[model samples]
Target chain A: MDLTFTPDEQAFRDEVRTWLSENAPSEPLPSGDTADGFALHLEWERKLFDARWSVVSWPREYGGREATLMEWLIFEEEYWLAGAPNRVTQNGIFLLAPTVFEFGTAEQQDRILPRMAAAEELWCQGWSEPDAGSDLAAIKSRAERDDDAGGWRIYGQKTWTTRGAFCDKLFGLFRTDPDAERHRGMTYLLVDLDAEGVTVRGVDRLDGDEGFAEVFFDGAFVPDADVLGGVNQGWSVAMSTTGSERGLTLRSPGRFMATAHRLVDLHRRCREEAAPDLRDAVARAWIQAEAYRWYTFATVTRMVDGHQPGAESSLNKIFWSELDVDMHRTALDLLGSGAELDEGAEGATDAGLWMKGYQFALSGPIYAGTNEIQRNIAAERVLGLPRK
Target chain B: MRFAFDDDQIDLRDAVRGLLADTCPPETVRTAWSNSTGRSDAAWGALADMGVVSMALPVDAGGLGLGALDWVLVLEETGRVALPEPVVETAVVGAPLLHALGCDVPAPPASIATLLDSGASLYADTAECLVVLDGDALRMVDPSTARLTAEVSVDRSRRLFAVEMAAGAGTVVATGPQARDAVAAARDRGALAAAAQLIGLAERMLATTVEYVSVRHQFGKPVGAQQALKHKLADVAVAIEFARPLVYRAAWSLDAGDPDSAVHVSMAKSQASDAAELAARHALQCHGAIGYSYECDLHLFMKRAWCLARSWGDARSHRDRVAAAVVDA
Candidate 1:
């Protein structure tokens, strides 16, 4: 049950730590300074690339260290702990890289994996459509077979696409057969964002940051080789994709650890007298965030043991998503009247990170699949309970 | 890294469960509740003999060297039976903290200790030893040494004591910065274990309600079949399930031994408090007027659930802790 890395893993951690210490940007990597922090984060990714530290888990043939999952977690924890800005290439390196490694052909891997690791391409998730947040199989986006050009023409709208507006490519799901069941006839596609008939429009989130966007395809062309898995097997591919999202990138412990540290620091700076209720709430927040840390550790252990996350990822998803919201809510409660301050407002405590976190946290349960949906998945699939 | 209990730990769980089944049955709890004793020493002794009391103690301390995670397994069983013993207070809360602080108390079997909150610690009650925190310092002292009055608390499952201690002999188990860290760790671990027990108690309470409603007929049908009662019970089930991971993850984190152990433990405790109270309330409501009867065991676990949940850092405190650690800038 020990969370400590094995000695070899520890050494690997030491090596990576030394490298990050040497190369990590001394300045806070640009986030708010840039119109899109995603672009700024790419610079950090390039730093990781130059150091050969990017995508630690991918095979060396495709620019990865082929490190173990534990080492990967160590790298991530240290990356955030070092005050590096969010890794912009996460969607590409963590999600797409792994999926392509597993389900992508040799040719597909050769084409996508290196570019993703090198930050040559930026990727955005295209799973959730307007009608499909929880029930992803209800995705109505279509990808009809274009036998003439040996490719598929995709036509669909994907919302909640984080960084979609600036993404160089789209890894998403589309229904290939209009007459098939919800889960069937879907295909996973990798489409060039600049291709004809494609449009990416920014959407205003509660944080007022254009972090998310809507990617609409009137008739997007995708080579048949761009099919992540087999035609009509998109559901499984999409499941694996979303699963990777939930299980890997979204479940990154560093994000929460940084947030958790920021939370404690916030309380220290913001609280005048440390109201009792706020104190207790802060403690619970730390406890859950800590729980998430270990929960992720446990998940990584399972993966290390050659087992993939299934219903257990549901547990992780629920814990992390809800904790994210609860943490911010507590911060807001602690701040009381002070929470009314808008971003960049004068004398704003924590520089309105709490406000932004509050807004971001609102999406925690909604995105990646709602907490309700995760709970139902756990009850029905994990517990084998009768679906109500 | 493995979450499953090893073979011996599994056997320990099964054995404690068997003892609980044989000795602390629902009927036994009912009788004990009706009596002024609230618990049976004979059953507690059986637990002590089975080494359940010393399950979490270090092996070098003449007890099983099971980790905090292992104790959670026993806690679940203890919760399942709704045993009226001080497993949380003595084993989970008191002894481990004391032992960790180098207190050479006999390794369990009968370590009768109660958790004393800051308010209670200041008021010195009838407890022999009290767990107390003064600012960032935690002191374990014999309350009999200090004269203070015990205040009436909301829950009465275990004796709540108010103890007075002059900031000394607790051997700096942890102090200054480490003091809060140590207290937070113990509090979180205790809360997580207690919450797991509460989950077991909640499950039993909900089950009792379901069984009672199913068999007790009203308006020419079983009360359980009624949507009103069914929905209430369903909600209870959902709360229990929802809180399950918070407890499991908390305990798992503590057992897994992470730095954020304190935070995770609080979530479990906080979530358990909400879930257990809701389940108890709904279970009592579902039982109707009969659930209030002295002959029923529902109130025993219910009273214990409410009592344990509020003690050792209540839901509000835990929630605050979580927020502080999670939402800061």
Candidate 2:
């Protein structure tokens, strides 16, 4: 197997490297929780959209470069290496957009994709509910046909909706047939967040940020045109989103590699006081990151050759989630007493980025399907183990 | 960049796997432990007939002259069955070392073997020639010339010998800069081979444990149906899958002659070792009392994994090398 990039791929990387060096964000944008911060992130998305760098792998008609999978990976590496701001529109662009491309009608694609690319209609997922965290098929959210037979009326409460407070729309799963089987009755619907009878309450995360929210829909109207795939077939469509969440779309190896490099620098800076165990931990973090990078390369190659990722995505989810937590934990251990400092504290190192990241990393295993559930999926689907 | 094996490599892997499955089954491995030499001549002859012994030797030396990456899958297959042979030492390390040294050392038809450090060498009693890296020099000595004291290893299938070579007993194959490069390359290859083998060992152990748990009943049901055992096996599966890419990447780095090949090799070795150790612990726990016994086939792979985990370099030693590369850079 060849590890060196083709000359054309190298040229593409150089092009991306040059462009990022000249035009990447100079300062960090505000967190996309508050209205002001959301506006700032939307502007950043606009800038990327104008440069056709918002979604490089998407078709050109959807405001992307229609780049190859390898090129998309290269772009991610360059973007993270350049210290680019996090994509606030990821819930729509990375998660929902792929499903839409796979299952949405042409009209839906024409009406929804461009706005998502520009972050004009930011989106959040509505899959998880208070009562249906891991047992997703047990969701009690219901959607019934309106009296006029024009659309559906949705009534449900979706919790852990990341960026829900800032999002303009949501792609939610609602049971359309009450008497049908657990997975057969669900319908995937697109609902406007500002529509009548919709309310969002922010949930304060460990870092004291409203990064997610609980969205309440009280008879919210969604036209028949907003339904994705087909009625009562949402389970299969939503599986696409879960696949994207576990696959390369949600967490790119470049982010971990960049963090790993930073950890190495920290280890070097504190080499004198760092314990032997801490040194090994730092080295292990880098090695795991490198392994992840190579694994992603193999995955992207398979995808480029027109094969879909299967149970391996479950393996990827478990691996990256654990790696993220371990890497952050190691960094905190290296920080010692300084780890307790928040970003607002005076003379905080790295503005307490590691502490903040540790908080976020804690959510990795919990969100995008819990690691326990992912492990079950891997065991049952990948290892051919019997389910209880 | 492609990070997968080519068709020829895939065929090579399948062929090696088939041969091992047919000739080097666990029963054969167990029986070999009682043999005087503790080496399975049948399996060795099969591998030799397949030209695996000379796969890494230079073309000028009447060999295939394949690179390290090409031999990775074969080494992994050998590890899967815990093949009681010095293929890793002879084919992967010694032959490459002799080829690079351009010395008139005994070739593959006459088995060659090598060792990592000075502690013990594998198959030194059976090999015609033993290649050892002494400081910056690569030395070749007749096994009969050295004091070969048989030592028992944790894995019974492997027969280890402590070699005490007298001064000037070995012919210096290469010295100075050439010797240093050859020694470094051999170390990297050795580490990579060990790492690949560990992955295979983990994979086999995990698969065997999964199969055992599927049929073993507990609390009126199969234990594999329980979340605890399933999760443990899943964790082992995750570790094995992730460690594989690192081994492949390290092999690629070595073949490419990259400057950072040493770091990649160390990382692969460390990761593979950790994965194999985890697999061994969990495999035994899941298999219960039977896996701990020699009668059960699971102990064969589990013990081999334990021995291989500390063979080329233990996890800590490899991590220390990595620390030197990244932390001390």
Candidate 3:
């Protein structure tokens, strides 16, 4: 087995690197004082889409480069390394698009994909009800067929709907047969955000990033064509989409390396009176960052080799989430007494970006399935141990 | 970029597996550990005859000329059998370094090779060439060219040696910063090889534990059915799986002539070392008191894992090197 990129691949890398150097953002764009960062990120996404460099892994039929997995990984690495804005349409590009390509009807694909590619269609996940979190199979949201209406009426409460309040569309799951077994009755559907009887309420997080919300669907009508996969097959469709979210959202090692560089930058810009723990914390952060970089490289290599991500993806998730938390904690440790100050405090650099990152990291393991869940996955699936 | 072995590599790995299984039986390894030679010379010679020792040597040197990945393919088998011989020293270290040094390094025992510093110095009495360095001074000596001494080592599995060089007993193979660089590169390669073996040992240890837990009854149920112990086993499994790819990546990079091989080599080696030690320890814990006994055969893999983990370089040292390179990069 060889891990070295071919000369052609290296040339591709150079081209990507040069393009990013010229086009990527030099500073974070303003997102306004709101939960949705879509306004700023959507602009950045359009620039990438115009360049035809967005969604490298998608097939050529879907406005993608049709690149190899290795190339896709490299593109992401370079993109993040260039300090580009976070992907604003990832829910569409990474999750919904792939599912559509594999399982959605042609009509469905034709309708949603181009708008998604142009960043004109912002999407949000409508998974995880107040009662059903990790136990996703227990979703109680109801969707009933209406022959007269020529569509399904979705009546359910979906909580923890990330960015749902601002999204233009919702890709979610609901139980079509209440009497059926937990995993047997679910159906996946996509609904227009402006659909009647849909109410979105914000849930303010500790981090002050009000990105999550609860959505109550009262007789929300979704066209029959919006059903993803076959009727009872929604469970599997949801599973596939969830799997993509787990496996595809990882930031490449180069990005973490770039983050480490940022840490160095922060360290340098600090005043001489900065706490010494700040330096030590930065050093530790550097170590963890580099470690994750190597870890990511190894994982990417495995993925490029065509190994379907097994429980090992969970392991990567845990490592990265914990590392992110520790790194941000280190930032807080360095800020010392100043951490008590809110964002935009006088003399607070980058509006306390590190502190903001610290608070955001607290929700990482929780949102993308908890670390405990990941451990069980590793134990039960990867290790071939008997489930408890 | 493929991580799985091709057909030929799979065949070679299988052959190596058979050879190690036959030659380094637990009984045989323990016997050799207490023997005067502290190694199975017959087994070593047999391996050399079978091309294990000669696999990585250049085809022009009457050898197979296989690459670093091939060596990793075979080393995994070596760990499975807990072979007491220094195939790594003779095959990976001695042959390639000498090939690079442009010197015709002899076969082992006579070659007097130990890894950069994996195990205690073995066969000091008969070592014809001694490789050591201070700063940039690389001293290679024939026995008659240097004064030598021997020392008692705690690991009875291998003989230990000490030597004091005469004023001009050594000839510098390569000197100055370049030589240091070459040695550093060679040491990283050596560490990668050891890491591959550690992965093999960890795999075997986990396999053995799983098999035993499935059948061995405790409190009227199969031990594997227990959640507490299963979780521990799962932890070891995760560690092993995580380490394998890193080790494979390093070896593949080295084999493919990648410039970043050194950094990868250090990372893989450090992770593998930690995984192997954890796996071995957990295996013993799972095996209960019988695991402590020499008769159980688990100790064979455990001892090998323990030795290999600390050999070449320990985790902390490799981590420091990795840190320097990454920071500097």
Candidate 4:
């Protein structure tokens, strides 16, 4: 195996590194899930889209360079290392776009991707409902045929939608056939939050940011052209989206590598106060982060050879989710008494980023098919263990 | 960049693995513990015949001229079978020392008393020469001339011994800064080799555990059906999967002579050690009572994992090295 990158890939990395260093925002943008922060984040998104860095893996016709997966990973590494603003449009770029590229009609691709890439039409996923937290199939959201209008009328609520209060539209599943099985007869729909009879109520997260929204629908209309993968096939399509997003497809190791680097910096700063055990823990966290980078390289190697990542992605999710928690926890420990300080406190360190990240990482195990479900999938699917 | 083994490396690994499967099974390993000499002639001869004993040396030295990248997988195979042969000591650590020093060290069954990993050298009593890195100088002593005291290892297949030799010993083959650098690199090689082996040992143990849990019945169902147990095994699988790529990258780093090779090696060793230790702990736990018994084959792999997990810079030591490099740098 060749672990060294080719000269061409190296050149690509250098270019990304130089470009990000020069163009990335001088100051960190506010949390993108908040309304004002989202407006500022959209400005950053506009610049990225103008430079065609919005979606490096997509086709050039869609404002992308069509870079290889390896290049995509390099871009991610540079982006995170530069401390670039969060992509407020990730739900559209990462989650919805893959399925769109796979299942959207030519008209849909032409009309949707470009604007979405430009961040002109913000998008968020409408996956979770109050009743369907873990059992996503238990969603009771319904859609009815509106024959005269040539569209579908949607009904029900989607709660805990990240940045839903700020997003212009959404993509989620809605039951289209009442008589069909629980998993079947559902259709994946892209709906506009601004449409008539729709309500978006912002909810405060643990960090006190209104980063979540509960979208309520009463006869909100979505045209037939918005249906993805086809009617009654939402289960398989949604599964494919969530499966990859939970793995290396979305959460590139670059982000964690940056976090790990920051963690090392934190340790270096706190060396005097850090104990021998804390030093070891910091080293262990950094090592785990580096290990994850190599792990991703190996995985990307297989994928480049045309191998699909299957149940093994469950292994990936289980690993990085916990690694994220550990890395953040180690940082909090290094902060000691100072860690209790919230953001903007008189003497808060690292601007309370580690504390913010620790809170966010807590949700990592709970969201995207909780680690419990992911473990079960690993046992049943990868290990061939009996499913009870 | 490609991060996978090519066909040649994969073929070489599979070949050695197949040979060991036949020549060095659990019964053969058991024999090494009670045999007249700890050395396994059949396995060592077969490996030497295939050029594996000298794989890490230069081609001019009558060796395969392979780098850590090519030989690391084969070492992992040795770990898979828990082969009683001193492949790591002789091939990984010794052959290179001899080749670099330009010494005509006696044939295949050499041993080392290295400060890097071993306080006691393995197979030293049966070795033709017991080599030691005496600071900036490399020295070797005829095992017959040296006073060798046998030591009891938790894993009996590993025949460790304390070697005591006179000041001058037999010869000082190499000296000064070059020797010092070579020894340091050799230390990393030793640790990297152990890391690869730990991956193999963990995988084998996990596989055996998986097989046992799938079949062993309890409370009117297969014991593996329990969610709690399945999650534990799943975690073991996760740890092993993540640890392996680190071993591979570390081997690549060593072959490239990267400045960060030591850091990479430490990362690999720490992760692999944790993976193997986790496997050893949970494999026995999942297998229940029988796994602890001598009659069960799980102990054979489990005990080897226990010894090897800390053999080459236990997880904490390695992690501390990593911490110093990254934290201080």
C-alpha DockQ for predicted model 2? 0.86
Q: Tell me the deviation in Å of residue A330 in model 2.
A: 1.1
List model 3 lDDT by residue over B16-115, tens digit each. 7877777777677778768876776556767887788877777877778888877787988887776766667667775676667677754322444542
Q: What is the DockQ of each candidate?
A: 0.20, 0.86, 0.30, 0.79
Identify the runs in model 2 with alpha carbons over 4 angstroms from their true place. Answer: A147-149, B105-107, B134-136
Query: Measured by C-alpha RMSD in angstroms, how accurate is candidate 3?
Result: 3.8
The lDDT for every candidate, in the order shown, is: 0.72, 0.88, 0.73, 0.87
Reported per model, the fraction of native interface contacts reproduced equals 0.22, 0.85, 0.27, 0.82
TM-score of 2: 0.98
lDDT by residue for model 3 over A128-219, one digit each (tens)?
A: 99889988887899999998988899998998877777678999999988889888988988988788988888786676766778899999
Which candidate comes out best when scored by DockQ? 2
Clashing pairs in 3: none
CAPRI quality band, candidate 2: high
* Candidate 4 chain A: 10-residue stretch with minimal lDDT: A243-252
